[model samples]
Target: MRILAADIGGTNSRFAVFRVGPGPLEREGGLTLPSAGATDFISLLERVWAGLGAGPEDFDAAVLAVAGPVRGRTCHPPNISWGIDLERDWPGPTPCLLLNDFLAQAYACRTPAVAEARVIQPGTADPRGAMAVIGAGTGLGHCALLPLERGFTAVPSEGGHASFAFVGPEEGAYEEFLRKETGRPYAYGDLVVTGSGLSLLHRFHTGRDLTPIQVAAELRPDSPTLDWFARFYARACRNYALTVLATGGLYVSGGLAAKNPTVVDNDHFRAEFINSPAHAELLRNLPVLLNANENSGLYGAALFGQRALEHATGLEA
Candidate 1:
């Protein structure tokens, strides 16, 4: 089957064409485009279609992994100006599935596509247990996969929007500073653990506003901004693991984590991640992995598309 898959995050969107069936899933062509220039997903699709020289009619199925809370067939990504409705904006008559981007990544866990996913923390991986995936990008995105009889079931979450938990005096002080800076009572995890949040943290530490890109260029060995950023990310991961009881593993994906792996490579990162107090040991025993492959989302969308196509045709298992 010819399947088109798109992984739409808050910052960028990726498009790919895949051929899946009784053989290995294959990608025919793919492209990455910035989501900022366009006002809506249809416009973005036009650009992709023009670039690929193939329109929606060329594909038998399509799946979109959107960076937002997917309600039914629609999505309103936080940083992007546009929202997507599958029924209203889908390109063709073939079935289309809209899912939270991270949920799609969770689905990719079922494929050998993520076989190279890096294991940062070595621990027991319980095949039957639930697994968690979290990533920081235009915003923090999280999801979980519960092991089922035949495969795993992906569960989408807005855990990134949950209240940020300040664990230390420095974090508490930073929280106060954030409140004063944003005029908000509480810091949301997305605001303190993403690329934008990293930039904001850099501003808080250096009193100079710099985008994540600029900050990356000037980050020093003693950069408190990155230190705090790593801690917050670790804490967020820890919290999510606890929330979902992800004994199978915890996989971190997203532009932020994938780009700056050092954030989770140091001693402080592991210390923060395994610090669950009462259940610290339990947390310690769970594997912590990072989605090394950037295209996991697209691969996942293809997998989902294949399933959706089968279901719609009454051929699904």
Candidate 2:
């Protein structure tokens, strides 16, 4: 079956066509475009189809990984100005699904996206336990895969928007700085662990302004900004791991760790992740893996589409 797969984010929109059946998903065509370049979802989709030289009628089914909560067939992404209603937008009657970006990320965990993931912790994993997923891109995303008799179920989370914990006086100062900068009355993971988060962290520490890329370009393993970022990132991961009791494993996705693996592969991150007094032993025994594939979401969407296609075929049979 032919499938249309897309990963829509605040920064970019990626679209691809894949052939999936009894074998693995085979990519046909794909394209990526900056989200801000277009005014609305349909227009952006048009660009995608135009670039790929294919239309909705060309595919058997579609799965779109949206960067926000999906209510039924519609979504209002936080980072994007426009929203999506598949029923009104899609031109064909082929089965189409809208999945939360992180949900798709969870599905991608089983794909090749993490087949060769960089090991952050060599701790033993409980094969039957739950797995946690935390990734940082335009924003921080959280999800978990709960092992089940059938297989696994993806649990979506909006935890990133919740207030972040400040450890002490130093973090308190940084929290206050973030509060003032965002004018939101609190420091949240969405702003503290993403691209803009790097910019804010750099500005707070150096008393200078620079873009996220510039700050990232200057990141050294021993750099003070890198240290603070690593600590904050690790704290977020550790909290999520404990929240889900991720003994199966913790998989890190998104651009931050992919580009700067040292962010997760470092003493600072490891120390902070295992700092929990009550759960230190459990956390130490939990494995950690980081996926450097930035396009895993696309394949994930295709995998989801294939599942839906197979389910429909089963019902018909």
Candidate 3:
């Protein structure tokens, strides 16, 4: 079946075409465009379609994994001014589906046929246990997959917006700093573990006001931003894993993890992740993997669309 999938983020959107069969998915190609180039969601879709020289009707089904909370069929990413209404805004009659981008990443983990993902921590992978995913990109996103009779089911979450917990005196001071900057009583995990968050932390840790790009370029073993960001992310991951009881595995994806893998591959990250006082042993036993393929989101959307299409066909028959 012909399928179209789009992974839409705050800063960019990637589109891909696929043909699914009994074996595996065959990808045609993909296009990436700056999301802010358009003023509205529909216009962005139009531009993507025109650039591909195809109409929405060309696809059998479509799925859009968006970087925001999806309530029913509508989504409004906090960073973007445009809102998406799946029911009203679809450009064609193709059966369309909307999913939180991290939910798509979770689906990618359960995809039966996918490239062998990199295992950052080689703790045993339990197929029967729950799987979790945490990705730090433009923002932090978290999701889980529950094992089912056949495979797994994606459970979308807004855990990224959960209150940020200060694990120590240093983090406590950082919390006060953020409160003073935003005039808020509390901070969210997204504010401390994202691309923008790294920039903010860099400024606070080193008294250097560098842009995100500059910070990324400067990140290394000796960089204070890298050390702090890695530990902060590890702490967040440990908390979320405990909350979800993710014994299956916890996979990390997104631009930040993908770009600077060394941040997660060091002793700092491992120490912080396994720092839980009572459950340190349990944390150490759980696997931590990386979704190294940046296109995993696109592939995941295709998998979702393919499943929906097949289910619809079975119902019709």
Candidate 4:
């Protein structure tokens, strides 16, 4: 079946056409466009399909993953300006599925299409346990894959917006800064661990305004910004792992870590990730992996599309 998959994050939107059935899933064509330029998803989708030289009629199914909570057929992504309502905006007579972006990442675990994920923590993993997926990009995302009777079920979360835990005098100061910077009652995970958070952290240390890319590019040997970001990133991962009891594994899948792996691939991150006072041993035994493939989202969306198609036809076992 022809599946048109779209992975829409806060910063960038990626679209691809996949042939998912009977054989290996295949990609025909795709495009990545900046989500900043457009005011709506359908218009940007028009440009994306146009760039691929194919329109909606060419595909039998579509799966759209956006970085926000999905309500029925509509979603208003937190980071992006525009929201999408498949019921109102989708064109042509085709099947379309809406999903939270992190939920799509959850479905991506162990899929052959996005198999080259890197290993950060090589701990023992329970094959039947639940798996967690977290990533930092335009924002922070959290989700999990719970092992079920026959297969796995993807659970979406909006925990990134929840209050972030801060400890110690140093982190307490940072929390105050986060509150002042974000003007929120409490510092949330998305604001503390996202790309903008990196920039804000850098600004806190250096008192200079620099883009996330610039900060990453000008890293010194002992850059405090990277160090703190790594610690927080690890803390976020560690918390999510414990919350899900992700004995199967914990996969970090996001553009931020994918682009600058050093954030999650260092001693600082390692120390913080396994630093549970009561359950350190339990946390230490779970594998920590990173999906560096930016297109893994698209792969996941297509995989989900295939699954949905099968279920609709009562072919799912």
CA lDDT of 152 in candidate 4? 82
Candidate 2 lDDT tens digits, 1-317? 78889999999888888899898778887888999898988888788778988788888888889889888889999989999998788776667788899998989987876788988888988879999999998889999999999878889998889889988898899999998988987888998998899999999989889988889888888788999999999999999999999999899998888887877889999999999989999999888889998889998888888777878862122
RMSD score of candidate 4 (Å): 1.9
Winner on lDDT (1 vs 4): 4
| Alpha-carbon TM-score of each model against the true structure | 0.95, 0.96, 0.95, 0.97
What is the per-residue lDDT of model 4 for residues 76-135, given as tens digits with 9 covering 90 to 100?
A: 998988899887999978777889998888887757745888889898888899999999
Please list all clashing residue pairs in model 4, or write none if there are none. none
Model 1 lDDT, residue 88, Cα:
84
Q: Write the per-residue lDDT of candidate 1 for residues 178-261, one digit (tens) a residue.
A: 889888779998889988888888888889988998887776557787677878889999999999999999999888778778
lDDT of each: 0.85, 0.88, 0.85, 0.88
RMSD of each: 2.0, 1.9, 2.0, 1.9
Off by over 4 Å in 1: 313-317
lDDT of 1 at 282: 95
* Residue 132 lDDT (model 1): 93
Give me the runs in candidate 3 sitting further than 4 Å from their true place: 112-116, 313-317
Q: Which residue segments of model 2 deviate by more than 4 Å?
A: 313-317
Candidate 2 has its poorest 10 consecutive residues by lDDT at: 308-317
> Model 3: per-residue lDDT, tens digit, 78-138?
7677989977888767778888998888888757423667777889878899988998888
TM-score (C-alpha) between model 3 and the true structure: 0.95
